[model samples]
Target: MITTVRDYLAAHRRAKDAFPGALLLVVSVFASMAGPSGWHGPRAAPVLWTAAACAPLVWRSRAPVLVTVAVASVEVVHLASAPGQPLVPGASLIALYTLASRLPRRRAWVIGLVVTVALTVALAASRSDEVFAAGTLASFDLLVLSVALGDLTRSRRAHLAALSKRAEQAERTRDDEAARRVTAERVRIARDLHDVVAHHITLVNAQAGVAQHLVRTDAEAAYQALGQLKDNSRAALDELRATVGLLRQDDDVSEPRTPAPTLADLDDLAASFVHTGLPVQVTITGALRPAYPSIELAAYRITQEALTNTAKHAGPGATARVHLDYGDTALRVEITDTGNGVRAADMAATDGHGLIGMRERAAAFGGTLTAGPGRGGGFRVVAELPLPQDPGDAR
Candidate 1:
């Protein structure tokens, strides 16, 4: 019961129009009872007029202009009946304030001036005394004060609403940015896993085939092939573990054991392809220089993916070449294979995510990548990545 009463009181506080009306009613009753000695009117006359004036205030917020006019009209009648009474009552002030708060400044002020003038004239005509008495001036001042206070309240509410809208927009923008970053990170992780698994598994599959073929005729050759297969499997597992480690939560204390691959690891990569019976020749044109870790990683992954494709599609006697050109402004990586293995039409029809991943990686650094048939009847992929102006700025 107490909680119910508290809730009721809270709701009543939020709706304050009734409270003011009740207070004005009580004050008007008391004022009527305490009228001056010269007052010979009926005891109920002033009370009825005051009650009519204050009752309209209940709907002030819903129809502020109508309520203000009704209350002002009633007060004017009451003043005419009893000139010695107050010129403007609390109900009139409340109605005027509601009008000013609800309507625009020009309309509210114009209506307020008209009502003030009408009430002043009524009070002046009823009083055979001074035209502009102190009570009339005070009433005018109170009316102006009510309009000013109401306008201030309206301005303050508008400002707070604008601030709330801006805060909401900023929150939405932040959420969108965070979602974009999360999506980009997921794509990067998936691409890395694909590259690692595809490169190592391709070599392991080839070596397993070789080992199986040599098991009966050449035991020594079979043993070496099996060893290479084991090494390839182990390397694939290591890389898979490293790539998957990126998904760990911030609280995880363990770190990836092996670092990311770079251009320096190209020789080992070429050797692995050679082990699978695909000859890979690596050529560097420009002077070697340090590059950002991200650029190096992208370059290495592109080269690895290109060679993997070459091994899988390039038939017997097909050789691959990796050319790295380090220019002053950009680093270019090109991978080409002899089309004598897979026909140009078959290679063009090949659909896979490797090329897509490479393009994404290059574009991430504001670079460009192109893959098509080379002029020498071979498949070629060229990627050019811009370098920072200062070598020291590379990260």
Candidate 2:
């Protein structure tokens, strides 16, 4: 029941307006019963003056400056007519407080100073100067105190508003950053899909042409080409499914993701290129260490792209060698082919998108990649990826 009443008092505008004025009126009526000795005037006049002073507080918040001026004018008239009388200052105090809380600091302070001086002068003008001297000081103090309290309230409100605005801006920044990252990841996924399909389909197309040409003249050779086509097709499908599954939503519980290809699959990858008529030799030095999934996938994809480019651009019967060196702090991958290096025209034909994708992937894992002509009259691709410290052994 108390909660309900408090809520009603807060929500009801009329109740807020009436409550202070009603209390002041009751106090004024009671103080009037103390007689001329107690109030320094006839009981009826002081009561009427007090009522007049307290009545205007109803609209204090709505027209604070106007209410304050009106209440001050009433107090001056009351002091002039009934000097040294008991005055109810509630309405004027409410008005000044409301004005200070609503207006900007400089303007509110200026107005408060003017009102304080005016109240001091009016209280000092009484015939009994000795009695009203202390009242004058007291009135000035109350005026300043009211304005100070209002300014404090205003400052707190402004502080809260600023904090709320900063929080909203921070939230928006976080959302924008999240959206940008999501867009980058989608583009990365698209590039992977393109590389997977392009490399496999190019080999398939070339093998199919060979198979068709050799079907009558060389039956066994044609069958082998057809078998390679089947294997390439299956591998392409599996990689596609695995890559696409990564795009599934969290709640999509139907299909599970297959593990992505890593450095461990480099041997099988180079062997597959050899089946397509490109001989690739794999050489590894130093002990292998486990790496993060992203780093492993990046290494595999970079190697795949390099070998695919070799098969497509390098002439037939050209030998390619993949060298892996696991250093103390980094992993190095180098793919060199003894064929004509990538010509400017050839790089321009694909707009160098493959190389760009590889660079982006390498940079994503804080790695570096370079591709150009080899020192020994061929093409070479090299990447160095940093190795992170083991979490289990961290101090």
What is the TM-score of candidate 2?
Answer: 0.82
> What tens-digit string does per-residue lDDT give for candidate 1 at 1-395?
97986677567743566567777777766766664575443467766877888888778888899999999988887877776765446787888788888888889989988887777677666665454788667767787788888887777888999999999999999999999999999999999998898899889988988888999999999999999999989999999989999888889989656789999999999999888889899999886788899999999999999888888887767889999999999999999999554544464468368888889999999999988777786688899998878988886
Go through the candidates in order and give each one's C-alpha lDDT: 0.84, 0.81
Pick the lDDT winner: 1
Best by the TM-score measure: 1
User: Per-residue alpha-carbon lDDT of model 2 for 159-192, expressed as tens digits?
Assistant: 9999999999999999999999999989899889
Off by over 4 Å in 2: 1-63, 131-138, 389-395
Report the number of clashing residue pairs per model.
Answer: 0, 0
Deviation in angstroms for 369 in model 2? 1.1
Clashing residue pairs in candidate 2 are none
Lowest summed lDDT across 10 adjacent residues in model 2 is found at: 386-395
In TM-score terms, candidate 1 sits at 0.88
Can you give the TM-score per candidate against the true fold?
0.88, 0.82
